[model samples]
Target chain A: MRFRYQMWTVFLAVACWGLGSVAQAAELTVSAAISLKEAFGEIAAQFEKGRPGDKINFNFAASGELSQQIERGAPVDVFASAALKQMNDLDKKGLLLAGTNQPFARNRLVVVVPKGEAKVTSFEQLSKVGRLTIGNPRTVPAGQYASEALTRAGIYNTLLASQKIVFSENVRQALAYVEDGNVDAGIVYATDARTSQKVSVGFPVPANYSEPVVYPIAVVKDSKQPDLARAFVTFVLSAQGQEILQSKGFLGANQ
Target chain B: MTDPWFSLRLSLAVATLATLVVGVLGTAAGYFLAKSRFWGKDFLDALFTLPLVLPPTVVGFYLLGLLGKRGWFGQVLFAWTGWEILFTFQAAVIAATVMAMPLMVKTARAAIESVDPAYERAAYTLGKGRWRTFFQVTLPLAWKGIAAGLVLSFARALGEFGATLMVAGNIPGKTQTMPLAIYQTTQTGEDTTALALVAILTVTSLAVLVATNRLAQGRPW
Candidate 1:
């Protein structure tokens, strides 16, 4: 009987502890583009430090994939996307909180090659490369941008015809392929290129090569904690947040 | 970054829960198929075996279409409960269960069929009902094979990657299993972390398979 009483007390204590934590912290699920991983990690840490009991969870993927998840009723509180098109589509579908859409950062597309490999230095010379990788244009914003740039360089069709193009699930995967020396060259964000030491930027895709890469953030309409979600959005657009992003090789929204 | 043990714990929980669900449903389906002879039984067997042969991504796509909020039954569920099933821990279990069911059913069906029906008939003649005969006679004879199937189902559930990723959306410390963590770490160029996770999964799976082989050989140890 004494052992049974002890076991009951322990069970009750464990149950209460579980309930206590759930009651204390407000968890915000932010689904963001893969490119925002490092910057957003820093910002979330700082944001949670200021609001002691609040927790932030991130779901990082391609912007298009994130949008599709939101559309399919994913329980996302906030979304930070790498491209305007994805955000615009979510807005048109009434999935975003009204007036919460704001562009917080910008980035440039660049061509990267394995370190110490300099066979192709210019965009026009990409045709001579053995294997070129980019994110899948269907679901990755970086891939769409890379495709537009390749089209402008007049080698997109030739690369396709010659089977030199390898599509990756996301920009990071494209970067990984190049870093692993599996591909001769890859097109990815300048910010992503900065994250790896095994790859070096061959050249930045010209500004006129594709539409500007702007990152927009917003709160989801189905968020249970709309105020907390809006606060996170505000924090991401703050000067401190912009500083973090810029330090990671991203351009300020105004730029 | 997620705590290294978080994915391991989550994968164990998801796999265990999925195995429990698959054990019950698959065993029932297997027994029914073994005992009953009906029209189009071959088609039914083929249907049950489809998921085992179909690419996991294709199965994931079909699950998404059937369970997404805009989907047929999902729309009704959302309208009544305002709850979405996608991207949750429950979604991981559902994905694992679907992927692991075929293994359990096939193994259980073969095991039950291999059992001598004479024992069941003797139990019936001794005044035992069908359920009692099954529990007392047939089950004792077939438990070994059924147990092997359960272990196989658990291993399959633990390693499920593509379907779970599609449905559960890879949120670290929430829905990211070990396989998803390895994929994410590899993409992020964290080769050491990926290698560690890969080693853990390979060792665990190999141990499970060895245990399964021992069980199949009728060794209790």
Candidate 2:
């Protein structure tokens, strides 16, 4: 009985090993910016449906952080960043293939206040508020954009004099401050504001007020699935992907 | 040597100050818990170190809620005087103090317990008051152990992550500490800066560990 049981176990192990080897799936790791999380989750599901035998893994964080990981020799296959600075840094380091980086979408910077608050109406009124929440411009791209826009409007120093400025770690957090009414108002991406019902846009910062808001996508050169990465990039550029982005309030590449 | 570099120095400074405050408070609490017994003493002992076991993000969240303007304590403070602790370097210190408290407390407690109470009693018989006994006799004898605890707490404070991130929110030169700086570098794809910060932390951690080991070993004689 013992001999028979041992043989049965061995046979089962061999069969499982054989099956595992034959049907093993390829894993694709993609690191993306925090803003792309909701959109990318939908894209990953679609990508999986088309490529049945592959699994997609994702790591989402601030674009700056994602780029730093790639630079530190992280094994990310695809990188989707909210800004071009980090991508260009990787490109300069030869970590990314030249010409593979493409601008995919654009976002707008807007001033937001609590949903029911009647204190502020126009961007100019933001100056009258006692507090304005923003992300730390040095580390967060959205904050940098807000600072640039405020600078261009030439109200940056004026706003500084009248209001307390709360610096958050990311634009989403700044949005949260506004949503929760923790600050009189906050500066965040328009798409980020869409996720919360507790905040409303006071006004869009004019395009000329700040540097262009563009999101770039690129395939890391060290990717194990270079072909798949390229395919994924193409999919993002396709009309279908553009539709997904546009539906979520992001401007498509052509826009 | 740039903005990040300046941020790095500021972070180190904050962590150092945080370590000092936590060390003093934790050592006093640890000594009391280890050497004396009173009502609810055990519970109080555990409370001082609870932050160690609790999730840092949770600590940060509650801390934010507590320090925010609408929170009870903050509201009272604001009502009494126009003062705000949230989103400031002072808040960073509070987070670091809470996060590193357990290390110092646990370490100091162990050292205090390891010293035989008979020695303390002998000093008491030599006409020392409880406070004097502790400061003059018990403290000197246990100084090495306390030093070890201090170093351990300092190292723990230097690497504080989630709580600092949550409460301090990574404001460069204001709330950013070493771990936050490293995290920011990695996020931004500034590999050189990240790598440099990592090396610096590694060396500092090793030096602290060495000092901790020597202190823990007690006097050779």
Tens digits of per-residue lDDT for model 2, A1-255: 354355336434533442332222346767778677667767877877888877766655567656655654445678889987888888888988667898989998888899989756666787778789888989889989998988887778887776578889887668767877889898888888777677888888887888888999999987768989888888888888888888877888767
Docking class of 1: acceptable
Candidate 2 chain A minimal-lDDT segment of 10 residues: A16-25
Q: Which stretches of candidate 2 lie over 4 Å from their true place?
A: A1-25, B1-221
Give me the runs in candidate 1 sitting further than 4 Å from their true place. Answer: A1-26, B61-84
The fraction of reference A/B contacts recovered in model 1 reads 0.27
Best by lDDT: 1
For each candidate, give its TM-score against the true structure. 0.88, 0.54
What's model 1's lDDT at B65?
A: 71
Q: Give me the TM-scores of chain B across the candidates.
A: 0.93, 0.87
lDDT of 1: 0.83
lDDT of 2 at A234: 86
Model 1 TM-score (2 dp): 0.88
